[model samples]
Target: MDLSAINPVLLLASLLVAATPLLLAAIGETIVERAGVLNLGVEGMMITGAICGFAICVNTGSPVTGLVAAAIGGAALSLVFAFLTQVALANQVASGLALTLFGLGLSALLGQNYQGIKPPSFPRFDIPLLADIPVLGPILFRQDPVVYLALALTLATWAFLKFTRAGLILRAVGENHDAAHALGYKVIRIRTLAILFGGALAGMGGAYISLIRVPQWTEGMTAGIGWIALALVVFGAWKPLRVALGAFLFGGIEVVQLNLQAAGVAIPVEILAMSPYLITILVLVIMSADRSGAPASLGRSFHASH
Candidate 1:
C-alpha cells in the first residue's frame, strides 16, 4: 500500500461530504423522535427523495429545483405515515414500515427511466481567505452549502430544544403526551409537523446524494443510509452535536476504507465495503451498553383519551 497516496486533508474533506447525507437525515430523525413520534420510513423517504431530485434535475437541469422537489416528495410520502399515525391514530411502527415499502416501490417505478442518468451538481461554497488556508482550507472552508446548512440546523435545533418555549412544549409532549394533552397542546398536530420536518430533511439528504454524492440515479441508491441515520440518532442519544459526530465518525471510516482499497491496500474489498455497517452496529452496541443516553419515551406511542 502506498501510504502517500492517501492525503489526510483530502480524506477529511471526503469524509465531510460522505457524512452530509447521514447528518441531514439523523438530525431530522432526532427532531421527530424528540416529538414523541417514531417514523421508521426514513429509508423510504430518502430514496424517494433521491429519485425525485434526480428526475427533476434531469428534466429541468437545475440542481436547486431538484433538491426542492426531493424535499416535497419526501414530505409527501411522510404525509401518508402522518395521516395514518396522527390523524387515523394507527400504530406508528406499522405505518412507518408501510411507508418504507411504499417509498421503495414508488421510487423504483419513478426511477425506472432515470436509471444511470446523472443530475446537475450542487454548488460548492469556498470561503474567502479561510478557503485559501493551507491544509485546513478544504477541510473547513470548502463545502457544499448543504453541509453548512446541516451544521446550522444542529445548533438551531439544540437551542430550540433547550431554550425556546416551543421546544419545551415539544419535549414535554414527547416525554409525556398525556400531560401535554392535558395542558391543551395538540399532540397530534405537533407530532404531524415534526414528522413533516423529518421527512423534508431526509429528503434533502437524499437529494444531496443524487446531486452531489452519487451524482446519478439508481434503484435503491440510498443503500441503507436511512437506517444508518436512524441508528445515528440513537447513538447520539438524540442530541444534535453527538449525532453529527457519529455521522463524521462513520463517514470517516467509509472514506478511509474506500481510499485504502483505491490505493491497492491488501484488505479484502468486501470487508472494506462493509466497514460502514459494521461500524454502525459496533457503535450501537457500545451506546446500548451505557443505556442511559436514550430518550425515556422513545418509540412509545402517545394516546390521549377523554
Candidate 2:
C-alpha cells in the first residue's frame, strides 16, 4: 500500500470533479421532486446526453455545441415522460422506467459508430489570483467551469427554494397538488417545467462524463450515476444543501476507492470496484430512518382537470 502516492490536494480536486456530475443530476431531480413530479428516467436521459454530446462534439469539434446538444437530447427524452404522465395521465413510475429503457437502447444505437472515439476536451478555467494561493487555492480555484456552476447552482437552488414565491408555490404543489390546483396554481405546468429542467441538468451531467471526465464515448458510460443521484435526493430529504453533501460524500468515496486500487491494496478487485455502490446502499439504509419530509405528491400523477 503506497500511501505516499496519494496527495491530499489532488484528492480533493478529483473529488470535486467526481462530484460535479452527481451534483448536477441530484440538484435537477431535487427541482423535479420539489414540483411534485418523480421522473425516474434520469439514467436514460443522462446516457442519451452522453451519446448526443459525444456525437455532436465529434462532428463539430466544439465542446460547447456538444454540451448544448446533450441538454437538448435529455430534454427531448424527458418531454416524452412529461407527455406520458402529465398529458396522457400514465403512471409516472412506469413511464419513467420505460423512458430509461428507451434511452439506454437509443443511446447504444446512436453511439455504435462512435465507439473508442475521443471528444474534444473542455479547458479548465483557473482563477487568476485564487488559483495561486496555497492548498485551498488549487483545490477550489483551478477547477473547470462546470464545477463552479454546480456549486453556484446549489446555492441558487437553496435560495430559490427558501426565498422565492415560485419556490413557495412549488413546495406547496409538492406538498399537496390538489390544494395547489384549487388555489389557481398550475400544478401540471409547474411539474412539466421542472421535469424539463431536470432533464436538461441530467443531460449536462451526462455530457460532463463524456466530454470532461473520461473525454471519450462508450455504451452505458453513465454507469448508473443517475440512480445514485436519485438516492441522493432521498438522502438529502429534498434539500439542496443536504443533496450537495450527499453528492460530495459519494464523490469522495469514489475517489478514495480509485486511489486504494491505485495504491496496490490487497483488497479483492471486485470488492474495491463495488466500494461506492456499497457505501450508497449503506447510506441509504441509514438515511431511510426518516422519510416524513418527502413531498406528499411525490411520484403521484397530477392533472389539473380544469
C-alpha local distance difference test of each model: 0.89, 0.93
Q: Give one digit per residue, the lDDT tens place, for model 1 in 131-230.
A: 9999889997899888888888888988998899999998888888888899999988998899999999999999889889978888888999999999
* lDDT digits (tens) for residues 21-121 of candidate 2: 99999999999998888889999999999999999999999898998999999999999999999999999889989999999999999999999887878
RMSD of 2: 1.1
**Which of the numbered candidates is closest to the native, going by highest lDDT?**
2
Clash list (residue pairs), candidate 2: none
The segments of candidate 2 whose C-alpha lies over 4 angstroms from its true place after superposition are: none
Q: How many Å off is the CA of 147 in candidate 1?
A: 1.3
Residue 158, candidate 1: C-alpha displacement in angstroms: 1.2
Enumerate residue pairs that collide in model 1: none
Q: What count of clashes does model 1 give?
A: 0
Model 1 TM-score (2 dp): 0.97
